[model samples]
Target chain A: MYQNPRAMPSAFQPVPALAIPQGDREGALLVAYANGDPEAAREIMAALAPRVLAQALRMLADRAEAEDVTQDAFLRLWRIAPEWRQGEAKVSTWLHRVTANLCTDRLRRRRRSVGLDEVAEPEDPAPSVAARMQGEARLRALSDALAQLPERQAQAVSLRHLEGLSNPEIAAVMEIGVEAVESLTARGKRALAALLRGRKAELGYDED
Target chain B: MTRIETGADGGRELDDLLAEARALEVVPSAALWARLAADAERERPRPRTVVPAVPPAPGGWRGWLRLLGGWPAVGGFVAATLAGIWIGAAPPTGVSSVLPSLWGEDVSVALGVDEDPLSLLEG
Candidate 1:
């Protein structure tokens, strides 16, 4: 199992060795994969699959759907390899764009399958008294707040804050201008803050 | 007291909320990764060497045409048609080019002109 360097609790951790190289990594992998190197394709997939899945889950709010979308995205990457232009954009950003487009398609199909009103909320587990008295309430509050956002706003917020992508990067992934990404994230944050404010007492958070 | 000060406080609160949200752990299951890898592998292209076309029977006109034309002939036809349309639609130049003179001496009866139009052209 690969350990995530970002998951470490320490303030300082050595950067991951498998972290993608800046200059030639995207071009080399794309060229090799296009030339029918399965190993090169697998390496790129391994590095990117986790974050892509995470982004899908945040968008779809369903583990099964997220897995399907991630698979579809990678499958598209394989098919599109021959047409890839070197240095047009970062490979990671291109994959993110593919994943987002897949998620959008999935959302559209889901809307047809089940009406928005009938879309089920994930069942919340009962919190123990001790857990509720601690940080669990805050976590639950935050999750609920996130669930309330409109789809694009939630996606922009998750990509920017949770995934740590810059505005330009998020714009590339979302297929929009940087200014639009900034607007979506800003509005998402404001809405989240408003939603969480009334539940501060329940969350056991100190007043500002 | 000022609009900028109020906006700064809002921004700080937003940052705090976002930081809290980011702390939540949400890793996808291992089985999901396995499925993705399998799908990617299935979609990977198989490389094949390009093979030369087999020659047709010695007496056929089809074989002769194929040898002469190939893809280049088809490409040339498309290029010529596009070029012809592009040139045909371009605007005509100079006033006289579009409106030809019908007032020449032999052509004067056609327009019922009494004298040469060039005589009127001497301003």
Candidate 2:
């Protein structure tokens, strides 16, 4: 199904919700992988790699680095399968945490390489062609705004909203209290709204 | 002021952004899963017994034997061998009595005893 931009703002276009799979099935698959089932490993990879890649892409804004993050995420996953505890934490939560840490470490390295004392979004960062398509401008703006948020808040918002994880799941992933998760997301959303307020027309909202 | 309504609209706009984010789908390359499978193949050698839940076919030649009549055939062969050995060593009570020549000698001759033990032997 295609959307005519004239018919409705892409923002208002109804979107089918992301299926947040039960962490238990994922947990069971991990157990299967731990027990050396290659099929199970394949299943886990298929199920999780896209989400890992998505989170990485949003965080790093570099395809090569995001791919690397995804690969590393899975490599670590392969190594940890044997020691994985099934019910203690959701598999997706653990994966998001792993990918986030990887992204943060890479970002830190980039900051150090640039000799900047503070980690900052690179100035005039060029979005890839695929990132700049018509409907995706909003995503790019949101991503840019996300990049500007304090790193923790950015990550919190990314996990909570972009990654479709619930507050409790994010709390488990971020290793923070649910109330803290609530605070971070609230602050992050408010900051995002303020940042993008001026660009509404350019970003193609308010046509209605 | 219109600012309050703007803020409310902005929040709705933010909600819309989140929905769009959810709509953003990224699929990993097929090669990624292949690489993981290769790694899993390599690293799967944990010391735990990996027996399938369905219980894999018994493994080597034992599996073959299982496929072909398992213990019953082997047990029958063993029983037959034991019976043959017992017969060669010492047959059952009636087994030898019917044919004394089968032993190749008169066992009574060894003791110099007549067929009727009640008769006194002539010197």
Candidate 3:
């Protein structure tokens, strides 16, 4: 269904390929690192760490935890450098998958320990307090709704909608077929819409 | 890219909120970068330095030294050869008296040969 980018709206268009390092480059860098090249290690980290951390932050909504997840993901990358098979997956996709799993584990633990209401809102560095509060509320609400989703659905929707990845890219990250990705994202969006519609007033959306 | 499916109620609002979330770029803090770099450095594989148990033996005749138990054994062999040469060149008086008797023993008698092998060739 997602094979044709032209058929989709511009907003659903694929992210610019140049924005991310190609899988081949990442794979080569990892091989270089395995061969004891420090520059390769630095280059790979510079290319991938921020995105990995951002994905973690989007899922966890906590910077400290996000940083931890990012670090853990990179450490795994470092350990896997020698064994990483190129062409199998993009480094970003692998890292995102790892980050998602880590975030899901933490979210599950947090749920067991504390109530969703007790989950702290993210601190946004917006220019004004009102904007910052609004940003925080939106993130907090989205995170809460996402937490309510099944793990795969949350990951698929986040990768598709928030990260702006193509269906094929989401398929690679989630290790599922494109049809499964479409099914999950569609169901996830419907659930998110339902959850958010109920909170339309609380989230400061105009009641039409 | 904001694709709000207007087909669903409040889809536009959801799309807007998601667009805003996407815009909420979480630039990794400098500290996070430092931490990652540190992790990369700490976890990088280092080249191994292999040290030989014995210093490499030199080549040619010197290479033979390894087979003959190295330089020390060669030195000992050289010393023994020189000692033999010196002893042969200048025997002690007591050794000279016994030298003739030592040489007097017939090779044919020693081997219990009835006749010399060279004498057979002559016949």
Give the per-residue lDDT digits (tens) of candidate 1, residues A1-208: 4344235343221223245366657556766667665566656766777778877765565667778888788787778888888777777887777776676666656655654334233345456755533444344444445556776876777677766788877888888899999899888877867766654445555556
Query: TM-score of chain B, candidate 3?
Result: 0.38
Off by over 4 Å in 2: A1-23, A58-63, A104-132, A206-208, B1-10, B46-123
Error of 1 at A92 (Å): 1.0
**With candidate 2 superimposed using the best TM-score fit, by how many Å does residue B11's alpha carbon deviate from the native?**
3.3
Q: Which candidate should be chosen as best, given DockQ against the real structure?
A: 3
Docking class of 1: incorrect
TM-score of each: 0.55, 0.56, 0.70
lDDT of 3 by residue, A3-54 (tens): 2222324321122323435547877777767767676766677678768878
Estimate the TM-score for candidate 1: 0.55
Q: What is the TM-score of chain B alone in each candidate?
A: 0.28, 0.28, 0.38
Encode model 3's per-residue lDDT on B3-112: one tens digit a residue: 53434543877887776666667667778777877888888787555889888878898778797998889899999999889879998797878977888744534465
lDDT by residue for model 2 over A1-208, one digit each (tens)?
2222133332221212123246477777777667655556555666677789888877665667888898888888878887888788878888999998887777666654543223232334356643455345566567666666777887887787777777887889999999998789778878878887766665657745
lDDT of 3 at A94: 87
Best by TM-score: 3
Give the winner by TM-score: 1 or 2.
2
- Give the winner by DockQ: 1 or 3: 3
Clashing pairs in 1: none
**What DockQ number belongs to candidate 3?**
0.31
